[model samples]
Target: MEQLTTSLDVMFILLGAILVLFMHAGFAFLEVGTVQHKNQVNALVKIMTDLGVSTVAYFFIGYGVAYGVFLGFNLDGQLTQAMTEKSGYELVKFFFLMTFAAAIPAIVSGGIAERARFYPVLLATFLTVAFIYPFFEGMAWNGNLGMQSWLETSYGAPFHDFAGSIVVHAVGGWIALAAIIVLGSRTGRYDSNGNMRHVYPPSSIPFLALGAWILSVGWFGFNVMSAQAIEGIQGLVAMNSLMAMVGGIIAATFVGDKDPGFIHNGPLAGLVAICAGSDVVSPLGALVIGLVAGALFVKAFTWTQKNLKIDDVLGVWPLHGLCGVWGAIAVGIFGSTALGGLGGVSMMSQILGTLAGVAVALIGGFLVYILVDKLMGLRMSDEDQYEGADLSIHKIHANPPKEEF
Candidate 1:
């Protein structure tokens, strides 16, 4: 019976690992559909390569940094001991989490698309996945360095991210913000007078919608599987995620005046916001959170581009970073017993933890990008940007429909 339970747990997490891995396709397609046709191939290639490199970095370096598990160079020896100790579960857990960590680069890729140098971005992906992300992840999930203990002692609860609304989404968003700022806007994105002069619309709405659907589907595994054990599963988490998704849809639809881009990203914003507290909050609370997240995404994305003049191609910072911060804090509000939630969470803890994540992500991302810029440069030349990343880096256009005729 014990063996059977252990096997079930392994299977559950392994399934989750596969599902989250599939989310990479969603990320790739989302970027592909958003960037100009000339840069579409670059988007696809970058996501795939980033995932590949991230896998290597996480296996050899990141997992150790996060959980203190050293996978020595000898794979044969590690597997033998793992099988004997019935600790094969750890392998699947790493697979699941490695997907989450890899998402940092995936998120950043969208913001810096079209202008970032490919190999340099790959290096950033490796460093972010290997070191920066795991540092915060270790503190949040694994209690590394006693940060969790200190939070609990000080605020009456450890930082209460049931999943990774703050840990993963917020961290990724902030890091993307840092990268985008350092890399600057894509060439011709703004005017010589510091006015917003460019408007690069989506290349394929169908592909964009398809990517959102894939992410929505895979998110079930992303959130539910975080339970990591069948015994720990709760239907509330699934239901909350659903409510938040629809709430985001409704809110974005109305607020965005039916813009397809906003409509599609609305659900993503909600899902991002609900990830932290889906298990604890009521469906209604999740709905409110989703609605607010949707509005926030629309408002923030527009303001950043038009007012602040930040060129986040896919609005990753707003969809993930700001909404993630709200989700982290909302868990405190909605997770209270007074609010029809499972209790034992502290708002102060949530705030502090969320702030800590932002600080780490921003500082770490800036330093990594700045160091890379000085050493090897980060953005492509102006000539390369005008030529598009697909042709400049990949040596192919996404589609030569004009020439094919």
Candidate 2:
């Protein structure tokens, strides 16, 4: 019986890992569909760069920092028994955590798409995933300073993030915010009169729709993998994630005054919002959280663009930051054991832990962005910006003519 249970756990973990991997493709298509034609290649480049850098960083330093040494080893000794388990299941856990580290910094590239220097962006990706991001992951997800340890020692129940609202999404969103602030808006995004111009993307809407669908499917793994121990919990997480996506779509359509783009963004917001507490909340609660997240994302996107004058090319802040906050807080509101074997958290502890996670991510991300910007001059020259990164950086054109018959 024990052997069967162990095999099931390993299978679920692997399944979740596969799901998260698909999200990379989802992001690639989604960003490609949102940006202008001149910057389509640039958007794709950013996604590719993020993935490439993340792969190296996560394997070497990131895994050690997030799951192995920083999280498990203290001044005295290793923190968790799981870290020393030496079993195949333990190895799976390490790999699963590495994916989360890789995904967090992937958010930044989308926000700073067109004008960022490729080298500096690559550098930033390395620093974020390898160092800055893992620092917080160690604090929030690993066993030592992680929510579980904090809750076990300071409070009672663990800081109830079923998946990664604060750990992954918020970390990525805050880093993206910092990158945008340092890199500045894309060229001509702001006119001399200070009004923001509309920079439309060149890709087809079908691509964006396809990416969103893929990401929605990927989210099931993201939520379910976090359970790690429970069987029924994985099912619950998958169901909650789906319901939230549906709710987000419905809420975005109605709340955004029927803007199709806003409606389309709803599914992502819902997924982000439900991620933190998917295991704890009931399906109805997931729906409510998803609906609210969708509405908030629409408003937040508009406000960031029109009001705050922040040029988030792919609406990273709304999808990750604000919705992440909603997901974290939802743990307190809906994570009642009575609902379905979920979190039974106190309001104060949940709020405090969530805030702590946010603060660490924001501060660390901001510092890294500022350092990279000052040292490397993050943005390209005005000439390069007008010329487009594909031609200026890669020296390639989208539709080249044939050599002749």
Candidate 3:
């Protein structure tokens, strides 16, 4: 029974890792369909390569930094066979965690697309996955530096993020915010006097919608698989995820006034927000959370673009950053037993944890980008910008489509 159980656990986590890994395609296609045709190829290449670079960084440094386990090292500080009694559950777990770590760069890639140079962006990704992201991840997930203890002592219940609402999504979104500010708005995104310019329409609605669909489907795995063990999986997590998704879609549809782009992105915002409390919040609570997140994304996206003059190409900051914060804090409200949730959370802890995440993201993200900018520069020249990223960086258009009949 023990042998069989270990195998089952390994298989369960391996499946989850595969599912989250598939989300990368969703990310790629989403970006590819959103950017102008001229930059479409660059978007695809960026996601694919970011995952590649992130994998290398995480395997070599990020994983060790976050977990503090060096493969074969035992308590006595002596080497042992890599495979042990758990039958290599630790190795499979690394694969799962790496997918989450890689997502940090994938999220930032969309925010800074088109104008930024390729190599510099990759360098930043390497640094973020290898050091900055892992540092906060260690604090939040692994209890590094006794932060979770501090939160538990001061507040209550130790900042309950069952599935990385703040750790991954919020962290990604906040980091993207820093990169966007450092990179600045794409050329002509604003005027000399800081006025809004023409809004660029998406290259293909079909592809954009397709990307959204893929992400929505894969999210089931992302949320459900976070349980990490077959016995740990709960039907409530699945239920909350579904309710929040529909709520986001319905809310975005109405709030965006039936805009297809907003409608498609609506579900994503909801899912991102619900990730924190899906395991605990009621279905009704999940719906409300989704609705608010959907509406909030639209409002925040517009605010960032027009008011703050930040050009987050895919609105990642609003969808991931702000909504992520909302999700984490929502745990206090929605995850409480009084609201028909599982309880074991408090408002103060949520707030402090969210703030700590944002602080780390801003500080780490800015420092990495600043150093990279000074070293190799971040954005392409004006000439490259006008030429578009596909031609400028990749030396090819997305698809010439050969002349029509």
Worst 10 residues of 2 by lDDT: 70-79
For residue 121, model 1's alpha carbon misses the true position, in angstroms, by 0.3
Ranking by lDDT: 1, 3, 2
Report the alpha-carbon TM-score of model 3 versus the true structure.
0.96
Query: Cα lDDT of all candidates, in order?
Result: 0.92, 0.78, 0.90
| Ten residues in sequence with the least summed lDDT for candidate 3 | 72-81
- The clash numbers for all candidates, in the given order, read 0, 2, 0
Best by TM-score: 1
Per-residue lDDT of model 2, residues 273-322, tens digit only: 99888877999999999999999998898788877788898899778988
What's the TM-score of each model vs. the native?
Answer: 0.97, 0.90, 0.96
The candidate with the higher lDDT, 1 or 3, is 1
Best of the two (1, 3) by TM-score: 1
lDDT of 3 at 387: 97
Tens-digit lDDT track of model 1 for 170-236: 9999999999999999888889888988899999998899889889899999999999998999999
For model 3, the stretches where C-alpha displacement exceeds 4 angstroms are: 71-85, 401-405
Tens-digit lDDT string for candidate 3 (51-135): 9999888877888789886543343431243356477787878889899999999999889988999999999999999998889
Decide which is better by lDDT, 2 or 3. 3
